[model samples]
Target: MSRIHSTHDDESIGSDSFLDVVSNIVGILIILVMVAGSRAKSYVREPGEAKSNIATAMDAEAAKADLRATRRTAQSLAGELDMLTREASTLANEVKAAEYARIQLGTFVATTEHELKKQRDELDDKTKRQHDLAARMVAARRKLDDLQREQISVVSTAAPEIVVKSYPSPISATVFTTEVHYRLLNKRLARVPFEELKDLLLDERRQLVWKLEDLPEVSGSVGPRDGFRLDYHFVRTVRGGSLTAAYYIPVESNLGEPFAEALAEGSQFRRAIERLDRQNTTITVWTYPDSFDEFRQLRKELYRLGFSVAGRPLDKDSRIGFSPGGSKSAAQ
Candidate 1:
């Protein structure tokens, strides 16, 4: 029994040992397989990690580039805004200057127009008064001529009646050569205030005396026995009732009856009247047509009333006073 038991123990021990060896071998093989698999997995994981790193780098680079472009665009926009502000300021200044100039010009035009209107009114008023004075002068002159022709005997007979020694017609001084000239001097010079014109006519008396003696008749109505000579003048009435006088003549006789007096005195008186008629025309004015026309019309009336005229009635180039005359019948 001991021997069988001992054998059994040995066998058991041996079998156990053999099973341990096989187990060891299998464990080794398993360890080796696990290492290989782990190596393969590591390789695949390393490649994927490299790819992810590359993608992250590319994305970062694109973001940096976009940031740089945005910064540049912001700078460009700021520059454009500055330029626009400067242009707007310049335009604003120009508009202000133009507005100021327009206001100044408008004021000047208004002032000038006002002055023009005032001047026109003054001119019209002056012209009307001048026309009336001329008319009175023409009437007085006509009466003087009539007196001389109708009253030759009275002038001759009266000793100190201021008889004209001789007077000529077609004269620059017209009628009233010597004695008549003196009488007129007493009458007109007393009332006349224009000393310059009065003096000039009176001073030219020597020339008038010479002209009287030189003419064909050259006699006075009431004085020395030479036949009466005639001087010519043009006379007319104007629109403002003024008289106009000139020194040209285009006369024609319309008388059908013979003269009442064949005496030298009568002839002189008649000749003096002829001269008076001719001298009543020539007049002039420097104004508008309305004013000038008024002067012209009055002169025409004087001529029709036996006032003589020689030249053109009135000129558009003349100046006459705007004041009222001394005569009661004068235009005011």
Candidate 2:
């Protein structure tokens, strides 16, 4: 019996050992499962990190390209600014040159005007001096002429016989049957009508006649006459109830027409001479001082027509009348 009970206890111990081995195998399987879960979580996180890194690299390359483009634009703007600065400098120089030229022109004009004024002043002074010299020369010549005239009178008195022979003879008018009268007033010459002269001469109240010799040489005198005598008379009256003397200027005859017009028609004072006998005709010219040159021309014309010419010169204020003697009279 004892031997059999001991065999049973040994078999029970062998079963307990087999049970412990099985429990150890199950704990080892649980540890392997926990390790596998940790590995899976690590793999998911690693893939996400790799994608973020790739995006960062692309953004860096794009920023570098933008920086290069901005630098190129800045360089272009600097070159344009240099060109504008050069143009501004050239414009400033041109303005300065124009200002200098304007100043020079103004100075030159002022100097020229001053010189012209000086020249004008000098010319005026010279003209005044010349006028003074001319006046002095005229006065000296007049004095010299007076001295010569006085010397001539002394020489003439030394030779009485020669002076007597040189004396003019008394002119006789009996030889001339036809006599014409002329008057000069101002510078105009006119012939006195024959009818008007006859009216004045026939007036008995104004009749005056005198005979004289050696009359003074005066204005309107029949100078140096030896063969003929002159007769003149006129009435005197007040004009407009004033003290001024009334002068009756006779109507001019057609013979006293313009010489130019007469010459153009080939007719002159010859027409009046043809109406009378050539040997008995005489011409008397009453001349003013201003008409001396014109009287010379008339004298030459009368001589060509074979007629004698007598001249009676008058002063500026003389009037036509007869002297108490049988000669032309003049009154102021």
What's each prediction's clash count? 49, 9
Query: What residue pairs clash in candidate 2, if any at all?
Result: 169-226, 170-226, 170-227, 171-226, 171-227, 171-228, 172-227, 172-228, 220-313
Reference-based TM-score of each model: 0.26, 0.32
In the range 124-212, model 2's lDDT, one tens digit per residue, is 99999999999999999999999999999898876555433221223534423566766654445555553343354444222221111
lDDT value for candidate 1?
A: 0.39
Reference-based lDDT, residue 235, model 2: 32
Off by over 4 Å in 2: 1-176, 185-187, 200-255, 262-268, 326-332
Write the residue-wise lDDT of candidate 1 on 146-251 in tens digits. Answer: 8887699676775765754332233433322211110011011111122233344344443445554444323211111121112222122232122122111112
Model 1 TM-score is 0.26
Give the lDDT of residue 165 in candidate 2: 24
**lDDT on C-alpha atoms for all candidate structures:** 0.39, 0.51
Steric clash count of candidate 1 = 49
